[model samples]
Target: MTERKEINVLNENVARIEQEQPIGISVLGPGAADWEFWLTSAGFKLANQEDADVILWVDPEAKDFPAIAKDPRCIVVGNSKTNALCQQKKITYVKDVNDGEGIQRQLEEFGRKTRETLENPTLAKSRSLTVPPALSPQRPEKKHGIRLQRGLIKRHLPPDAPLEDPKGELREEFREESGPLSRRKDIIAALPSLGEDERRLKQYIQEKSEGEYRVLEVAESYADLIRAAEKGFFEVILVHRELPGLERNLVENLKLLREKAPGTRIILIERQSDDFSAMYKGHLDVIDLEWQVIPELPGHLVSLLKGQYERQPENHVVFKWEDERKPVTSLPSVRTSVLSPALIAYHSAGGGVGKSTGATQMGFVFAEMGYKTLIIELDTEKPSLLRAVGAAEDCPGLAAWNHSDFISERTAIEAIRRTSRQVHGLYVLPVGPISPKKVVLPFHLEGLNGGEEENVDPCQQAAVFYSAALKEFQIVIVDTNNSCVDPPVFMALKMAKRVFYVMEATKVFLDSAEAHIEQAYDLGIQLSNYRIILNKCTANDLLSLRTITQTLEIPVSLQVPLDVEGYRLAAHQGKPYKPKTKKGISPWGEFCQNVLQDLEVPITTSQAKKPSLRNWLLGWKKKS
Candidate 1:
């Protein structure tokens, strides 16, 4: 029995090595399912069929094959509905690679040469099969393996799907979260031994990463590790190589992470005196004690991690209209072209005339064209500009400890994100998450009370939020939803360098416009800072727009033709519509640009401000 088992194992290995050839093999349709299962189950390399000696076409119904002719290795298997796709190619037949006795029988009959016989291996070899006698159950139990016995797994496949055979869950799990459950076993099993051997290493790191830089405990699983790397989580990622179960899948997954998330830095885990030459190809930070003269791996790790901890991609807006693109918001902000320190105010009398949309267009364009712009969403009601720019993630809000004063400024700036990548140089950070709307108070806690005053408070807080964000930005656009209760909204209106009152050209819109204008006027807001933006306006409604602006103290800033296609596409895909041409473009952007030009903010690079990453990281690092 032992000799037979040894010969069988040798035969299987020889068959695999001899038959296998370098190639990129893709088993689309039903075959992908089996390919993944078999490859993963057997720890096989998924060689590309393009460089292979064979193309194993598995499905029966795919389209006719493209060009190419007779080849010995093109084997089509199974009673597939996909054979039509291979009509143009030189086809051979293999009922199945996994077909039982038939495969061995055919190979034997053909007298296929064994590539080589492995008589000796370095492994601590043992052929010990222990079969435990079945113990009678204390009680006769109903079968719980009904699902597996019935072959119910295939029932989960999607209807008529592509690549359904190798549904990528195992491969995806492998690619996504460092691959399948088996790989998880490899990573964890590798750690227990390493920890047992490396005590001084951990202690050394603790000593070096002293002060504000301290080690945040080690990550155990791929998920826990990833969770640490997420926004506002732990900072450094350290890896150790003593893990024996490392697989190609693990390495590939890490590579995927590097591309999708470029900010993360990975530390190679190696012992203090291990040879470094073998690991250098990974192309990441190597903290091996074997090659370095540094003391205490833990302390050195702490030092390296201190510099890289807590990194978020600098908020940058890309402006790309079709092909031409560049970072626009980083540009030096001119005073409305020369209005210095002007407050941008927005207001509406009734709800929804594109106030948010107008704000988004202006804010994004200003940010894109090289002005440090922050568009603040102040409306807590129904959908507003936050939704348009995809900024209103949760009720378009900032997560405040309280409204009294935003707990010291860090909370607001840290919450911003570039909402959409519209062009070469544009970004959007949506409004704060709004869940279950109202800010509630506990019955016993009397320090904070729930009241109608909450409505006006957020509006008041917008200025504070805007001012703080502007410290790092050049232009800030504040969009306030029309609220009757808030006196602070009026104060915000009065403080504007320019305000866009977006309205339709209809009589109802005009009426709404008048009411909004009056509200701001009552608040003592300088009517001059406000401008009329006629959104969705037609050539026919030009008269009403002019009349409304003229009657009010405000002037018509822009009569924007309705651009539904680009804007709608942007919202749907979570992207932005990059506008073409500088003049008479988006109502907000063109208006904001005009405001900057009027304020004398420099437009061209000859007068543009220099790029500054110096503001982001080290004030005086060696690299700087």
Candidate 2:
């Protein structure tokens, strides 16, 4: 049994190697599928008769042959009669395959002979004449070969040139003297590894600048490069195309660099023969280099420096073999609106966690403090803002606007209704009953029938409404549904500038919050964009907060004291909570005040007022 297993393993390896061959083989005649399968399993790619590198005719009495079978590459595989017929036609013939081992040997010998014949001087010359020299004879060790060439270039440098400063202290001192705020150029070279290429480039820059340019930092790894860029330590970043971690994470690293150092110029150093169209799609300049021009690198550095000083519009510098200048097309400029509103979303892991309550109350506070605030109820499955703010359930609101024939800024503004006079500049756009019923279907399921002419994606419609709201309101607070998986809620979270993930102080709630956070991350939500808000907290909840912070590695930005009675009484009256003490201070009021402070909302002494005894007594009675 063991010997049989060994033979099976050997056959599998042979099949794999055969299938990986570049030139595929085709088998004709009876049992072709089985033969093809066996050939592929032994490691040979199968191709059509016309396109195959070799064709095997297996049928003994077959008269017709594919046009390609007439070529010397074709062979006949069968009994002795087939071999005799093949000799009459000057075609190669092999004994019929009776076992896997015999067939394997025949295929191996055929591949070796085919390769040798293809590599003949006459065949190679013809192939070379047709293909471009640049595309000819690609070697796996070319990258290392280029490195070696660079080393040779360094060895032949003029003896008069000063050795590069090992510590680069001169560059550091220059940077300190000029300062980051200075207009002088501070360059950083990020290479795959510290070698002759880096040393040669650094020397060239220093010699060409004659004290003008400073190599601020040299990074050898992706992490170091990103760290330096994030710190904004340099004005120009020179990236070596062969940098470690670049091939796998090129797009990610480039995006991060663009974001971290928007003002800094990025120059990608690449081989002159490389196709860099993909790299050009990003915000980077390409500097094409050749081995022959390694000695003249200083001249190129000086030209780049001159261009920088002159404020040239072109970002790329291409050096061709003929030393011809190539025109570079500039990337399009990004446009941004000046009046961008602050969009904040309040979300929770589960129901009854005071997410909507906090969002509405916060919006009210912002409005009362004189900022135009709009509180949007995005929970389509269960619309609650209408009930929370005591508005009529049938009121035309977000749903009506979404399903309207034409929605605009005017339509959005008209959809919102002013909250009670308690909060002056606040407006509420409730998720009306009709829209909720229409949009409550699972995201994966389709065919949502709203009372409109056409079906629209709930998330897309919400985005349009949100955009219009942004144009009318200074601050938009979105109250998302409990489930983070909801399409509308997920979209809101993505659009929000700041997301407040509200959670109750309990084991079950914490567990839900943890799961929600994981889901949010999977949806590409950045941890930096979200802050955990511990709501309904007691003295004992402090320990749990610490544990949560340590476990999730997220900061708890706000903790609201457990004010169940205050909240219940306020809810029963269908009104936002008011200060219960004489000094215009209560647990609920204090929490709101702290929230305002944390959000950086400006507060004036005039905004505060003395508490009303009637309201205070009513709340106290309700609590008792």
For all predicted structures, in order, the TM-scores are 0.45, 0.39
lDDT of 1 at 522: 76
Which stretches in model 2 have alpha-carbon errors above 4 Å?
Answer: 1-340, 380-382, 402-425, 433-458, 579-584, 587-624
lDDT of 2 by residue, 266-367 (tens): 676654424554544443322111111122233355556545433332224222222321122221111112144677899987778888878876765554
Q: Candidate 1 — what's its lDDT?
A: 0.41
Cα lDDT computed for each candidate against the true fold: 0.41, 0.53
How would you encode candidate 1's per-residue C-alpha lDDT over 1-624 as one tens digit per residue? 866765665556445444432123344444445443332212123445554333455443434243223433345554433333344344554433433233323332221121121232311143232111232113222111111110111222232443212532221111111111101100111121223223333333434332222222233334323322332111234554432223234454454333322222345445444454346444432211112222223334443445543443223311111222222222221111222444576667767566776666666556444444556555656544444653323322343324443433444443332121112122333334435454321111234455643444454455555554555345667677676345435545655667777777787877777776676567676666667777776677735755776677677777777767656654543334533322323445456658777756656211122324333123212111
Once superposed on the true structure, which residue ranges of model 1 sit more than 4 Å away at CA? 1-61, 64-343, 384-387, 390-405, 410-429, 434-460, 484-488, 578-589, 604-624
Q: What is the C-alpha RMSD of each candidate to the true structure, in Å?
A: 19.0, 31.2
